[model samples]
Target: MSGRKAQAARNDELILQAARAVFTADPGAPIAAVAERAGVGISALYRRYPSKEALLQKLCGDGLKLYIEVTERALAEEGDPWEAFAGYLRGIVDADTNSLTIKLAGTFQPTEELGHYAMRASALATEIHRRTVEAGVLRPDLTTADIALLLEQIASIRVGDERRISELRHRHLALMMDALRLPPARRELPGPAVTDEELSSRWWTGS
Candidate 1:
């Protein structure tokens, strides 16, 4: 790409990173806050996003894209199903996608494009869960929704800097993974598994 295009791309990435950090911390923050965090001129930010809602949509869309990539990669793996499942959970934790979900749900109206990405990501995740269960490793009663909520619960932990946060998340997630792999006769999770409808309703569109 040309110099101008490369610069524009870099600016876009910076704006996105700033927006994620800003809005994830405070969904009600003003658009100017993102520009300040990004160290970009407000005019330049508006030239790209135009509105805070627009930037929010992009952040959510990018998050769903990352989820899709992670799940799809896990689905394509040829190793043991349990290992694939564990790696998938680890990927989601490392990506920190659930933090965005925890902070941004219902904050912006979902567009059709975002809906498509969400569906694709959900389907891929469900397939991974199905394979793991069929292999008799994952708990039969656990649903994909449970895993999503579990990961989101982990993301809510904020003790220190990014490195410490990651260490804690992975540490806790490993314990949860072991629980998920326990013999069904020996352990049963309480409460009903969250349905996809319930999960989607957390968003503004309720789709």
Candidate 2:
């Protein structure tokens, strides 16, 4: 990367760190305050982000990448297919409910870049589903689409309290997984389809 691009990346990182600190301290804090904390001019922040929603989207995407990394590692380490699936599910839920993640999920819009990231994540999720199904750990009827939908729903839940979010996610995930254990006879459910509108509405409430 060129010097300017590197500097821009550094600035973006600094701004993200500052935004997390300010938002964690006060979710309703002003963007100007974030810029102040980041030691950048408000104009500079705007030039980089264009809108608060854009900033939040970038932050959320970054958080999701981290989540994916952990999930991938767990899947590799855990020898049992079911255990790997469970680990991935829990990792995703934990990442989604993280304070920074939650704040971004509540505020960000689904941009093109975000959509690409989602697609990549969905592909990985599908692979996990396929592996589990082949191992007879997941119901043969359970499709990767279904798993993705369940994950999206879990990710969209917005409990402001971190502990409450974590507990609720765990409870829901357990219940959902139990339901996925189907009888041998009924083993072919269709995958759930996700629409752009549905995803955009879930995270971005803005008009």
Candidate 3:
């Protein structure tokens, strides 16, 4: 690629990274805040994203795409079904995709493109849950929808620094993983499992 084109690509990534940190912290943050966070001129950000909603759409689109890719990779991985399931959770937690869900929920309109990606990701996750349960490692009553909420619960935690946050997330995740695993002496969970319908309802427009 040409030098200018390459530089533009780098700048775009920087802006997107900044947008993730900014909007994921405060979805109400202005577009200019992203430019400032990215150390890019406001005019340049405008030239690329046009508006705050446009930037948000890009962030969600990119995040959804990354999530689908991670799920597909986890499914393709060789070894124990339990390992794949655990690895998948670890991957998404490290990706911190749920931060976008927590911070950007109801912040923007749902597009058909984003909806398609979400559906695909959900299907892939369901397949992983099925395989893990069939392997007798996961609790049978835990639904695929529960995985989403579980990850969200883990992602809700925040600590001193990025390194500390990651450590805490992984630590909590390991504990949660133990709880999720099937055990001989455990009693049945009392509540009804989360439904896919409820998961779908989170998207305001039914996308």
Candidate 4:
């Protein structure tokens, strides 16, 4: 890419980051405030995002990408199925609470990019579910669909206070993990475990 284009992309990212911070502070804040926080001319902001909804959509997409990256890293570094599951759940809740992405995800109509990111996130959760189940750590009766629904429900939470939200998120994830424990007879499934690649392909590419 040309230097000008690269610079424009950088500026756009900065603006989105600023907008995220503002939204996290107050989801109902004004577009003018976001532009001001971004340190960009209002006209320039409009030129890039066109409207408040568009700017919010961009923020959601960017934030989802960041969340996915963190989850992937956590999964890669951990060995224990329980630890990996906890890390993934905690990451999602923390990301939703702090990232502007979750703030705007439900409020605005999503673009294709946002939808794709959501699919990938859901797939990751499914893979986590499959892993825990296969490892005899979770109930064999739990399907990937159930895990996806739980993740969606968790992501939908909206708390006005950041501290309270953080605490609640932690408690909720812990409870969810604890509830995954299975009895002796329901320890394992007959089928193969779900791989990350399989889950990603099934949900994201639909192949």
Error of 3 at 160 (Å): 0.8
Tens digit of per-residue lDDT, candidate 2, span 99-134:
564445455458787778777766776778778888
Q: Can you write out model 4's per-residue Cα lDDT over 7-93, one digit (the tens) per residue?
A: 788878778878887886678888889889878889878889898888778777766787677667666856887677667767767
lDDT string, candidate 3, 1-207, tens digits: 899999899999999999999998888899989999999999989999998988999999888998998899889988988888889999999999999999997999988999999899989988999888998999999998788999999899775458767877887787788889876334443334435665465465635
Model 1 CA lDDT for position 151? 97
Better of 2 and 3 by lDDT: 3
Work out candidate 2's RMSD over C-alphas.
10.2
lDDT for each of the candidates?
A: 0.86, 0.70, 0.86, 0.69
User: What's the TM-score of each model vs. the native?
Assistant: 0.87, 0.59, 0.87, 0.62
lDDT of 1 at 19: 94
Minimum summed lDDT over a 10-residue window in model 4 is located at 184-193
Model 1 clashing residue pairs (backbone): none
| lDDT head-to-head 1 vs 2, winner | 1
Go through the candidates in order and give the C-alpha RMSD of each one to the true structure: 9.2, 10.2, 9.5, 13.0
lDDT of 1 by residue, 1-207 (tens): 999999999999999999999998999999999999999999999999989989999999998999899989988889888888878998999889999999999988999999999999988988999899998999899998999999999899675558767777777777788789945323333334435654565465535
